[model samples]
Target: THARAHLPAAGAAAMDVAESPDLQAQLAAAVHALNHASHPSARLAANQWLLGLQRSPHAWALAVSLLASADHPSPSADLLFFAAQMLRRKIQSPDYSLPDNAAQLLDALLVAARRFCLAPPRLLTQICLALAALALRAEGGVDGLFARMPHLPDPALLELLTVLPEEVAQDESGDTGVDSATRCRFARELLMHAPAVLEFLLAQSEKPAAADGVPLHERNHRILRCLLSWVRAGCFSGAPASALAAHPLLTFAFNSLQAFFSFEVAIEVMTELVSQYQELPQAFLSKMPYIREVLLLPALANRSEKIIAGLTSLMCEVGQAAPGLVAEGSNEALSLSDALLRCVAFSSEDWEIAESTLQFWCSLAHCILGIDEQTSKRNATQELFLPVFSSLLDALLFRAQIIDIDEHCTGRVSSIPDGLVQFRLNLEELLVDICLLLGAPAYINKVCLFC
Candidate 1:
């Protein structure tokens, strides 16, 4: 009787399986059996069956709960990966909203993340990525996910950063098979909303002895670059930059820049700084002397034309914000003017560099002229602006000679011809502007000598 009863329910019950309470009970039994079964194949089959039933929320919650339990110490890697995939799908699903138990689930995942750090690096990275995704989604749904994760200690946060670069590299290389759009979305979310996480990363960079075999400087630089990228990406949105600036994390960034002056990092950080705070230049000049020598100068004297253009725009920000300070030998203005003259005089083989250099000179001249007219130190201002203008015109003359030499040797007259035309036009315009501003023929004549 028992065998026959299990074989087929006969009559109406068997025919109406969809509505049968017995059938529902049978399916629940199967799901629970699969979840607890000792056999790996049985667990996989159970998950597949649950997925087929579209038990998204229930399956995800169970997976998260299983991960949270210390007794469930070592779930199969396949099971964990599938769980992560399901969670990701749930996040992407339009119909899915944060579950009532989301905060509990997130809390569980944070615990799991800490545990996963004790696992191998490959597994550790995957778990960290999954937890980051969950946290990011929780952020979007919950008003304050950070506040909710009050128990998430700094150790867990630092562990996440430890594996972040691996995850990023995998995602970037399509190793994780995550799409670019999704990766970018995750990065932007983490960067904008997770200030504490970023701060944690910055703090980790400061403690060389605490780092687990990773070079402190290399780690610090990479972390700094990553945060800078996030800030730049969110510039139009305004939220990320403002959030970062308001956080204590910025102190780490500022201190890191002060410790090391890589041309690349400096340019990136400085550009973001100026974009976020128009007054940042004055602040930097007042506090960070090293920033002037390393980052600001190389940027102004960058041989790359595109870099020079960006540097010029940055200098313009400096000039516009504090004309009086800039003209009065403020570290930034003096260093910038010197760099521009050197770049103009030396990097003349590239026509574009020469052109940018001249344009930068004009901007500097304009700023100086403005300061001279408005300030009490008229003589000192004239003295500063005059030498800079003379140096610029001399650079222009030097460039013309070099171009003529190249033209004479290579018979590339056309290459040099356009530059010469532009040079003359700029020189004439600069002279006229200076004459008008200075109200003196001698200043015009001094500029004319080099032209």
Candidate 2:
């Protein structure tokens, strides 16, 4: 009761002692008192109080001792759960840093978690993920983080995925709930250890399926999507390519794509891959023929501007990395371009979609021309490029005249008036480059007028 009365004061005092030179002795005495306390409630209270102190050697040591003690029978599952939650909170506090005994503390916590057998699965998973987070953060940088947790066990990696959805959905209400922070922190920690995590997923994908009904193809695809999300997040956050590439997981990720050859996943995966890696594998380029036309090309030709834009950006990345991969002989590229032009030429609703479609066409033209030098000996002709360029010029002129009419009107312009302004700008720049490449002004004057 006295301890409860002075709880606030006790917490402040503990925080003060946490930073003092006599911290070790003070923490030792506290642990002894905590262990001997007649009430389990008081012991839990003391543990919480100690964790509340800003991280110091003494506080960290006491928490470790309380969590690590093997002689005691496992605490009630509720108390154990709360203890794990409190420890996780301490680990996640942005101001706290793990002390030298972090690994030892983690080992002890793992032992306790197993022995106690925490329920709902998510709780135990949170504890492991927290430990992994601490281990990664303690290493400082990305490379150093990987160095500390190299070659993660397959079972451990699987455990993370197994618990991921529960952890992610814990706060389905989406309020500022405790589980929300816990879930976010756990994800941030996983990303910190991405290399090992990525590699483990890919390795699991390669293994033959168990006798259970689950198919290997579906399993690999699931794992691939999860890893791809991590890579996308890392790239979005400006993670360095060198740090990302050094990870064995990324190598496996790329290898999986090279091996699987699914056109659907490939379109999404390849765009992000080239954007992040800034290069595509020669193996991927060589196998472009295997890409399915029905799956990708028709979608590129649809009226959905956003989808068309995304596909265009992806194609540009591929062209920049490997120019000839999308040239005439590659039926995939030709079919995709043909479909895109048809979509533009036939669409009746809006000019913006047409403009984007035209821009995509121009970009494709530039890509083909860019590859001509590389394929010069193969006799890939100017004739093959002319029809596409001619179609683009016609689209550009139509868009420009629409813009002029809208500007000259007195009242509100049509909703879709002159959607091709940006497209014209891009087309103009592309024509300049193409003319320079062809070393002739014959088509340059006509194309420059649209710009």
Candidate 3:
């Protein structure tokens, strides 16, 4: 009955009155014709027909329903891609309104996404894009905020600004606004299914590379980007974003350097996670065992300077965000101290790691000495100095003694040629600071003597 109700009559007269199912079938047939039709006119007709269907109410329901399903009627990546595009277009239509069962539909899409665990990147990205669009639509038409969002409480807007970019917050759209009650409905829906959604994206990045020239990891990156945008929308706030920040699978994906593309994407995702870190509570921050794992990835340990540079930058920022949180394990302070020392002594082939490490050391030193020209008052750095300075002095002295051999390796080490003399002076300066923090004689006896 539903099919018959949707079926078009043989004549063009009934095309406008066709039911949803009928239009969907016609659109599918048109997509098939476009792909397989031999004659130019036939392909052109099919293309035009498909576009016409895209603007119809039926197109949104059909595409979203198909995506919401676990069993795809067609196996073609192109078909799924087509469905994804149409879904976005339908949502973008000015006359469109939320479907009767939009929540159920959202749930179905999440289910289908998890079900299509091995779906190709093209299909996955399209699905993600469609989902992203829905996220905006769910946010009460994406532009209603300017008319009302600005006047909300500071905490509300501030939190919202935290996740979304300024451009998104300020974007102007003419679409009719969604009911205030449902403004955050889509983001909340995503929060419930975030695990599956995030899991599927991470799994895509981990898929074994195919001989095909396509950069599969890039697709994973885009989908993850979609996820980040939603997270940044600032709906679920506390737990969901924190959970993603600490997910082990994501960590593994980032550490998978064998797949260089995936590793790069993971690096980027990890770097961006810091922005959300400021909101995480101390108890939640410790759950992040992935940090140490990423820091110690054999591929990035000391081999790939570019890769390690990203991780080091994240580390510095992480420290800035959370006073002592660095890497996983029982003894985080010691682990971070050792990690930074190793990062410096046998650091990258560029000064990025060395300079970052030196800065980190200085940052740590500042915590205790706090004696810059800015203020005369300095507080003791606490017990952390013992292990940290001990490890740091050994690395710095090692760095000072190794001389030109280490100098030539990191291209950014120094500007002057054969400038080992100046390099030692710089090293002495840092050591002097460390000694001031740990007590000059005490630091030399405990650390420098050993080095």
In terms of lDDT, the poorest run of 10 residues in model 2 is 1-10
The residue pairs in collision within model 1 are none
The better candidate by lDDT, 1 or 2, is: 1
Q: What tens digits encode model 2's per-residue C-alpha lDDT throughout 338-438?
A: 54544445444355555545444445556655554656633465556566555655555555554335555668655433445554565566556455444
Better of 1 and 3 by TM-score: 1
Using alpha carbons, what is the TM-score of model 1?
A: 0.51
- What is each predicted model's overall lDDT from 0 to 1? 0.53, 0.49, 0.52
Instruction: Give the RMSD in angstroms, all C-alphas superposed, for model 3.
Output: 12.5
Over 196-281, each residue of candidate 3 has an lDDT whose tens digit, in order, gives: 44454455445665422335565444445544554555423565655655666545544454455555555555555655656542
Candidate 3 TM-score, C-alpha based: 0.45
The 10-residue segment with the lowest total lDDT in model 3 = 1-10
Which 10-residue span in candidate 1 carries the lowest summed lDDT?
1-10
**What's model 3's overall lDDT?**
0.52
Q: Comparing candidate 2 with candidate 3, which one achieves the higher TM-score?
A: 2
Better of 1 and 2 by TM-score: 1
By TM-score, who's the top model here? Answer: 1
RMSD of each: 12.7, 12.9, 12.5
